[model samples]
Target: MEVKKVDFRNKIRHQRIMKNTSAEFTYSFPVIRGIQAGREYYTTMCPLKLVPRLFKFVEDDLPPDLRAQRTLNKQRIPALARYIIDNKESYAFSSLTVSIDGEVHFEPTDSDPIKSKLGVLSIPMESRFLINDGQHRRAAIEEALQECPELADETISVVFFVDAGLNRSQQMFADLNRYAVRTTRSLGILYDHRDPLAQLARTLADTVPVFAGMTEKEKTTISNRSRKLFTLSSIYQATKQLLRKGKNDKISNQEKKLAFEFWKEISNNIPDWNLCKQKKVAAYELRSDYVHAHGIALSALAIAGSALIATYPASWKKNLKAIKALDWSRHNKTIWEGRALIAGRLSKAKTNVTLTSNLLKQTLSIPLDPSEEEIEMHYAAGKK
Candidate 1:
């Protein structure tokens, strides 16, 4: 749907003071009509082309800094703009809240609903609008408009609220974000198909022995009765370690097969994992009693497997069986303490990861490098 420009003569301009049970104040705003996704909304729709000209972000040079919204994050704008430019056809955006401090007029329409009035909001040409929310979106739209001039006619909704002052604007920002919930990493990985790592993690969970029917697909932490020991995100990170793949590196079929085999071999070496799979040992018991049942240990095992594969590629599987002989019980203080555990509590710190991996390398008869040896010695001395 195309949004036609409003005629100045038909635009209504009037103002009325509104009163409520607790407070009475004047609200002056203009209602804009625009077409998007084959539907029309009465909310203000600022053209992508006009975003840069109409919105002013907080800057050091702007006078009265406190009145401005939060500082613009230049780094995050490009990625969002790229999404708009790439998916302009299907992209959807929520409305933005804007504030104007100068004088405005609101004229009610004849078809206005009861207890509510419709009007055309008008502000002087000299007046500027401040963004209380959606600054990043505004910046992204501005950038997207530059690369895609065809988007100039595309409309985005904007809500106009009468500017009370700096305090109210700050409160608006806080209120807008107060109840917002962020998606968990495991859930994001579980649902996302665009990321190759997420795809591989899901595949591993379904195909690998230890992960099959034993991985948490959505939540990061398992509940007491969850029946799962590892999270999808943890498997994703540990697989990245095993494969030595960077964030953006593409995975080939061969690499996927290798990862499947690597995890399968590790699972065979851990007896408790098999017992849990067979229903002989409860998932909760393994999780609570074994070091190998947690993400930290899985990641450390991946690190050790990477080293083993690099040093003993031809016989890595045979050597991985050594893990079965080692004491994996969380209560094995002599080995787990100061390595996977600190003061009888699990620690996921880099130092602990390094110490734990070094121990795995030694168990597999894979010689640790000088640095790994040094870290192991430090932990050993600390334990004494």
Candidate 2:
């Protein structure tokens, strides 16, 4: 038998337009496999290097009026790409959903039932493929491939569905994400060890007398009957502020020790915290009666601590005693009303945080900055 050379280019070339639409159009895609649910879908392995070339974020190039998918979140792509590059060994991504704009022909290579069922899924060169889900992953893969070309060989699974046109694609997008649930920030902090702040928060939750067994590890909110006074996320944010640490800042041994000491000293100075720990005061009572037990107050304390440590590093421990003298009761409307509370409702706004921290700093004899002095003047005048 004589072998004939196959012109692969000719086989894959776009077909000429026909005036009468009687011609059967088909695109043959070499797919790893295909699955059938309500509609036939093909699964293929796409190289990371080819991801950018093969998939297009059409939403970026298209005018707003013509766009089908939401605009690309450029800010998110860099972080995801960094994660991919940093954790190349362990990073895993779910399959990306794509829709091809033309009919697909799957050619089976073997007599196996599964192989025969899914044949080689083909996509014509002219057919447009839109990503319904995982556009972010596609963008990240492309960005990661630029820095780590060796990752080019790594394959990501792509699920291909024949395009049912714009309306179906839009429906597919909604259907794909209809059941998605985002992980809560507090749970992320509780479970994540990669973030220094999260790790520090977990450690503080376990080690600090005030936080020990009194930290809500999984949820952001404490239940009415819950003995936990603070949330893990709140502790994370407060400690991050106390240490003057940015989201990406590295924690040194000195910083860790300082944080440990700061929280311990704070726990000692805040009588309610000690009372709650000893069961003399119920966590619920403290939460209900004092601003100090809430996240807003903790964060305010952190701000004050930062100022105190910067201004009076040598005597900061002694100065912490001033916090014990201040009336931290929620009923102190003259002090907390416009600061931590507005109409007796707790506020977490920047202005409120500054006002509360300013009052604490003043109690510690830490001279107010000019801005703080102006705010204090405004507050005093308002009171008058």
Candidate 3:
């Protein structure tokens, strides 16, 4: 036989363990694997006196009756009874999970301490409160426990987690929301100015000749048409949306150029500027038939583009080429010259026209009084 001397402190520790032999031990340490240079080991430990006693013990006293569970309280109170009946199993009772300081703690009650001191709970159990799965089963459990306050402090199955640099909780939240059904309409207006789609629209706007080379006069002309520029912008936005495909089906630079070309044709040819004033009825007919009916009132950009392609079934390329070849400046120049010539005739008819050749040689500041020739000559110049 061998004999050994033991310290008094060690003796006291052994006495305490022996005194509470039936008391369950739940380890309060993280179950983690560690490598030390060449060897790997798994470690776990239980902290003594961690969970306080005096927490109440609770039990159903009798196993639940699966038959009495179906006993009804319907008829007189219909809706409430149906809800209870439909969700009976969930209302019966279920467990909850909670954490304190990143470590899971359950009240020290009658339940046996978990034998396996790691990972998640697989066995069915009950807890006082739930932590994460808020709306699913927790509401029912809370309702049941409200009538049975004696189970308030009852210890339940708990799984603990470490607080040090862990991301499992955040990842779990993301995964849950990721698979949730959602509506795209709720995303609001499609073109956020900061988004890539807006950049594409701006690029197309820059490439369209009517927009790119817009003079104040030309802008005024389009502005006078009420919804001209608006129609063009709508068409561009809609086309992009209709053509968009999968995440990988990105709009190429060339495709953006093509969209620009299509827009130029829509803007230039829609009104048929050459015959607009002469054939006013014809011009309005074309506008109503093509521009107003087909081009106006597009709320979404992608839809407008789709509408254009649908309306012009044959040779969109040919229409674009015709619009490109049409000349706007020559008719404008003719109008300008005709207006000047008319003004000259009207003034000349009012008074005789003449010019003194020497008047051109005089300095502007001379202030010389003019004879009939000078007055006639100034009038003959006719406000150039």
Listed per model in order, the count of residue pairs whose N, CA or C atoms clash below 3 Å is: 3, 7, 3
Q: Which structure among the candidates has the greatest lDDT?
A: 2
| Model 1, residue 24: C-alpha shift (Å) | 28
Give the lDDT ranking, best first: 2, 1, 3
121-215 per-residue lDDT for model 1 (tens digits): 65655566778888899989888988999998777778776676878777778887889888989999988766687899999999998789999
**Candidate 3 Cα errors over 4 Å, as ranges:** 1-199, 205-237, 241-248, 272-318, 321-384
Question: Model 1 segments beyond 4 Å from truth?
Answer: 1-42, 59-69, 78-93, 106-120, 143-155, 369-374
Best by TM-score: 2
- Writing each residue's lDDT as its tens digit, candidate 3 over 201-317 gives 555545655444221212212333443333333434355454553222457776666566655655555445333433344433433333222222122223333333454546554
Candidate 3 is scored at a TM of 0.25
Which window of 10 residues has the lowest lDDT sum in candidate 1? 7-16
Local distance difference test scores for all models: 0.79, 0.82, 0.33
Pairs that collide in candidate 1 are 14-106, 14-107, 30-121
Which of 1 and 3 is the better model by lDDT?
1
Which residue runs does candidate 2 get wrong by more than 4 Å? 1-37, 61-66, 109-119
